[model samples]
Target: MLRSVFLLTLCASVALCASEYRVKKASRASLNRLKRLINEKTEQQHSDEKKLIGVLDDSPLLVRDPTAQRHHDELAVNNLDEYFQGDVELSETQVEILEKEIVESAEDSKARRRRKVGKAPLYKRWDRTRPISYDFASSVPYSTRIKIRQAIQLWERKTCVRFQESGPNVDRLEFFDGGGCSSFVGRTGGTQGISISTPGCDVVGIISHEIGHALGIFHEQARPDQSSHITVNYRNIPIGRWNNFYPVSLSQADVFGLPYDAGSVMHYGAYGFATDPYTPTITTTDKNLQSTIGQRAGPSFLDFAAINIAYGCNQHCGYLPCRHNGYPNPNNCSECLCPDGFSGSICQYVQYTSCGAHIAVSQDSVSIYSPNHPYQFDSNSECVWLLEAPPGGKVFLEFEDVFQFGCEDTCDKSFVEVKTGPDFRVTGYRFCCSTRPTKRFQTLGNEMLVLFKGNRERSRGFKARVWSDVSPIFTTTSSTTTAATTTTTVSTTALTTVAVEESTTERLSVAVSHGVSGKEVAVKSVADAGNGSARESVSKRIANEKKNAHATSWFVLQERTF
Candidate 1:
């Protein structure tokens, strides 16, 4: 199951340890030393629109958990690509810059990796917990939505893009739903439109953010290894071959002055589970990615500068990443097409070009995996790799990171699609998608979802509309659900289920628009009935009278472990 997080942007007061990303005197000097390419690839500038400033969370992405924090800590010093072989290249100048970036961008170390890092915080002790779970969202109030909205606006101003609400009938963002699985804004398969749900009923700038994600912008703080100053050693991040993971996508619009921005709203505060948050200075380490320091929250001086360029004030001169072609050519790699380093439709490049861990080049598509759930039944419910499925089937893609999107982050809304059964529909997507890992970089189909059968097992494929990814690579191109519930459906050893337990979970519709989805699940048999006690799987207990009729179908609910 892909881990879910409920970030608590609600603050009772200013955090004492709240620190900003600091720029080291030496690092800054080095950055200034870089020689600009005389014949740099000139990028066409998109007129910057008015700034869209919303309240954003000025915190670091680091959270202290046993598994997650430990993982990050190891990453700080890890070689990253031991499993795969790829040539490392750089002229002396390029090597120097790359090294500096690695230094400034280094993430903190996990408590376990530290020989003498400060002790873990009181709230979360490294030894006490495996995966860190920072308590938040509970204390968040509905009104805070405006602050988050502002943060997003500020982000969009730095990265020009259009953000709007879901279609007329539907609203993508909800104000305050404690549901752990709640996402702020995303391109939904729903026909209504790109949706953004906030904690409360409405926050206008929320659309701007949703649009930003659709544009493939990433959180400023989520940059890889930028927390070494916090005493963690993310440098040790030992990744498999082809192992590249960054918080945001390169294609996504930059929030502002970064490569290092301690004040970037997307930043999380403090080190991973580090109780004592440091107070950062106005200048963060020059290298945004390798700075061995923690950053504080708030808009930095450079922040305003970048936003001014991205979002038009009196002058329009920036960019709004579309789903087509041509993106920020900061490195002048545009003309080289597979330039010195970078590949993909719109040049989705990776610093370490190996997929030893998070992703690997699949014969189909690059496949990423979630931790196997505790109760996953092998063979029957085992996670299945799906290239396609009938709309309203068991699994589907929420975004089109690679297949649909070829350029930088784009939310043209043209690619967002969904289907269920015979009803094929299309709707606009509000947010963005990108291949950059620095921006919490994730691609569509980067994660896997699994579904199970209740009555009988059929391996046949169905179809109606073709949108994106499917599960077990099955042909369940068409399927529907009628929820009455209380039915216990399990698969046998022949099937494998992939997913970890989440406080909240999402059951997706196979179709694009909910209208088609509703129709797909129109059958009267499926009900939302399950044993209240069964935590692992949904249990729908059949009524006593119906149980006596031999059986509705020859389906057996067997529990099998993968």
Candidate 2:
């Protein structure tokens, strides 16, 4: 009698939970109607657009339209499916709650326009302190599973969010081979389902994008500040596709103080839902970024930064100092997660490249040019130049002579990026066309980073001159010489050992010597140390010595050479 009573109570609880998260499946008639509508829309799309989409279908880096694939998967998920905003699957209760919020926001539309940023509610965000559980269905393809793992690694590398295979956790994500790519936003009670179809939705960027939704991130274009950056063309949009361009209200999403990013992997392509393929449905305010909007080349630096902020990843190393808009790395608190063109332990150095340099700016203009300027540059190459001026001064740049690269509407193939703004984290102004820029550029701060990327269809690159507004009080060469001449004496009775390591193009040399009392042994090393293993070994040895030698005083100097 007791066993029967317990079973009845358990069954009642399960039935109540099911009603709260119930999804209404589509009927066969609804699926057939949606198929006919898709056929009609496909016939309207231009031939050139179809060809362009086909060429970029398999490319991971290039920007491409995935609307056709999305539509195809939509059928697989079944027509008349109760999908919210095209791809998100929400419970019946969730839909009502979101709808109520939308109606409330619409009532105060005028007030909402004054606000900026978009963020999910705090209650909906996952608890970052705990590991998020996930599992893959047995039916998921091996290749698709690999892509999903790669996507998960990228998120873990960039943020404090942790994920593990499903264990005893009741609230978890279960990945299965559905007809479309879709997921519920944030964490819901019990096991939530995420669909990742094979052949169509297996790209790393696409997988990352879907995982982003599960992490509570909405589409980038849905931000409240989107209107300031992009213009949506409703006339070019097909019927029933206007919902894809709807912007989320400020009350629904938070921007976390990040500016609008056109290159976010979550952004839709220019012709995403366009009936007239020649016209873009979404156009960037900065016309140069037209091709950048729909990029699926992994997450942008801002995307990772935003996630880190959302998950409170920076709190892990609040005591550490990072420069140039960088934050402390969650995985390694000793180091910083830098922007695209910056590196070093604290993001104080420009990312080193074989063809670039660290240039000191003076009142006299210094000429800077791409590698093999006036000649076709090598394919698949990247270079970065750091231009610095004295304190309280700004660097000025002017383009001169020839300027050419692989030209695209959005400068996707090859481009020269100049970062002149005060914030180094955002995407910089890019130039790839053959024509030289008519106007000069000036940095808001004392430093500026210029990057050049070359693709297979290379051409003669650009030439530019840079100078400082204020003359330096002292030359860098003089300052270095003065510091080098200074000396310190150490009074040690015991013999002191010193080791020096240096590498040239031909060989690596290590020298160890002993010094007598009252004499100090100063060791210096220099090299174009492109190889990482040598540095790693040196670091490991220094760390081991520091850990083992408790009584002895040890001084270690490490330098990065480019």
TM-score of each: 0.22, 0.67
Tens digits of lDDT, candidate 1, 440-505? 221232322111111112122111111233333212212233332221121122222221111212
Per-residue lDDT tens digits of candidate 2, residues 366-472?
A: 66677678788878877777777767989998989889876543444577888885787777766666766656788888988888889647688888878888754
Estimate every model's Cα lDDT from 0 to 1: 0.24, 0.60
Please give the lDDT score at residue 23 for candidate 1.
Answer: 9
Query: What lDDT does model 1 reach?
Result: 0.24
After superposition, the stretches of candidate 1 with alpha carbons farther than 4 Å from their true spots are 1-215, 221-259, 273-562
lDDT of 1 at 255: 35
Error of 1 at 495 (Å): 85
lDDT at residue 545 of model 1 (Cα atoms)? 13
